[model samples]
Target: MGIRHIDVRLCNGCNICVEDCPLDVLRLDEATKKAYIAYLRDCQSCFLCQSECPQDAIRCVAVHERRMPKAW
Candidate 1:
C-alpha cells in the first residue's frame, strides 16, 4: 500500500512521521504545524510513518489489488 491520506484532525503536529519516513514522503507544514503529504510518488508505503505516528493520523491504502491509481 502507498501513503493515502493523513487525518489532520488526529495529527497533533508531531514530527515523528516526518523524522522516520525513510523515503521522505511527508513533511510538517510550517504554517499549519500539521503533517501533509510532500512527495507522494516517492512514498515507499512501508507504513513506518503510520506505525511511528503517536496519534495515528497517517492512513494508507492497499496497493496489492492494483497499484495505487496514478491519478492520485
Candidate 2:
C-alpha cells in the first residue's frame, strides 16, 4: 500500500526521488541506474518521492491512505 510501483522504463535515473526521500526508502540501482524501493517498510507514504520524480515513474497509495506525520 506504500510505494506501489516504479516504472523503470520511464525513469531517467535523475536521482531526485532517491535524494528526496526523507526516510531513505528509495535507492539508485548501480547496474540499471534506475530507482528502486530499497526499504518499502520504512516508507511513511508522504508522497515526496512521487512528487519529486521528474520522470513520474514513482507511484504510491492515495494521500488519504498515508500516515503523514503531524507538523509541529
Candidate 3:
C-alpha cells in the first residue's frame, strides 16, 4: 500500500502533488490535468504529496502497509 487514492473531482490541476513528491511518485496527466500515481512502488509513505495538496485530493496508506524491497 502506498498512494491510496486521488480524488480527481476535487483536484484543480494545481500540480502541487506532482512537484512536492520527493520520490517522483506522482504525475500530472496532460490531457485530464489531474494528478495520479505514476510510480506507486516508489512511494516512501512520506505524506508530502498529501500534506502539500491544496485541494486535499491525495490520500496515502500508513507506513506500516508500505511495500518492502526484497534482498537480492
Candidate 4:
C-alpha cells in the first residue's frame, strides 16, 4: 500500500488538485466544497496537485502501515 490519504483541511476546493491527479483518485465533495480521494489505490505518488495548489493545501504523504516503518 502507498500513502494516498489526503489532508482535507489543507484542501481549498480549488479543483486544481483534482485536475492534476492523473490517477483519477481525487474527487470533489460537492457537499463539503472540498476534495476527497475515493480510489486511493489508484494513486501514483505524482505530486502534481501539490505543485499547483496556490493555498499550499494539497499534499502527498506516506501512510506507513502499523507493521511497517513510520512515516518520514
Candidate 5:
C-alpha cells in the first residue's frame, strides 16, 4: 500500500509535496515530472504532503484503511 496517492492530472510537478514529506516518502519523478510514492512504508502519516500541495493532488489514507481496496 502506498502512503499517498498523487493525482497526476492535478499535479503540476511543483515538488512541494516531496519537499514537505518528513519521512522523505515522496519524490518527484524525473521522467514523468510528477510526484510519486518513493517509500510508502516509511511514511509517518503526518499529512504534510497533502497540506502543502497547492493543487491538492496528495491523498494519504489511514494506515488501517490501507488494507481495504481503494478506488483512488
Candidate 6:
C-alpha cells in the first residue's frame, strides 16, 4: 500500500470521484457503502475530489511514512 485518502463521513457514494478522476484511481464500494482508493499510486494529490466533495470530508496526507491511522 502506498498512501490513501478517504472521507467516509463526507462520502455518500455519489460516484462523483469516479466520474471526475482523470486517472481512474477511485471507486465506490457497494458492500461498505463508501469510496475506496483502488490505485493510490496513481493519485496526483490535486485535491479535485476533495474540492468536489460536498461533505468536506476529504483530506490529502503523506503516505510513505505512518502517523495517524483511520482519519478522513
Best by TM-score: 3
Ranking by TM-score: 3, 1, 2, 5, 6, 4
Listed per candidate, the RMSD to the true structure in angstroms reads 5.1, 4.2, 3.1, 5.3, 6.4, 7.8
Give TM per candidate. 0.82, 0.81, 0.84, 0.68, 0.79, 0.70
Worst 10 residues of 5 by lDDT: 61-70
lDDT of 1 by residue, 20-67 (tens): 888888889999999999888888778888788899888887464245
| Clash number by candidate, in order | 0, 0, 0, 0, 0, 0
lDDT of 3 by residue, 1-72 (tens): 468899999999999888888888888999999988888877888888888888898888876455467797
lDDT for model 3 comes to 0.85
Error of 4 at 14 (Å): 1.1
Candidate 3: segments with Cα more than 4 A from true spot: 64-72
Clashes of 1: 0
**How far in Å is the alpha carbon of 7 misplaced in model 3?**
0.4
Give the range of the ten consecutive residues with the poorest summed lDDT in model 3.
61-70
How far is 38's C-alpha from truth in model 3 (Å)?
0.5
Off by over 4 Å in 4: 1-5, 62-72
- Give candidate 2 regions above 4 Å deviation: 63-72
lDDT for model 2 comes to: 0.83
Give the winner by lDDT: 3
lDDT of model 6 at residue 35? 81
- Ordered from best to worst lDDT, the candidate numbers read 3, 1, 2, 5, 6, 4
> Candidate 4 or 6, higher lDDT?
6
Cα shift from native, residue 14, model 2 (Å): 0.3
Over the stretch 7-35, how does candidate 4's per-residue lDDT look in tens digits?
77777788877777787777899999898
Identify the superior model by lDDT, candidate 2 or candidate 6.
2
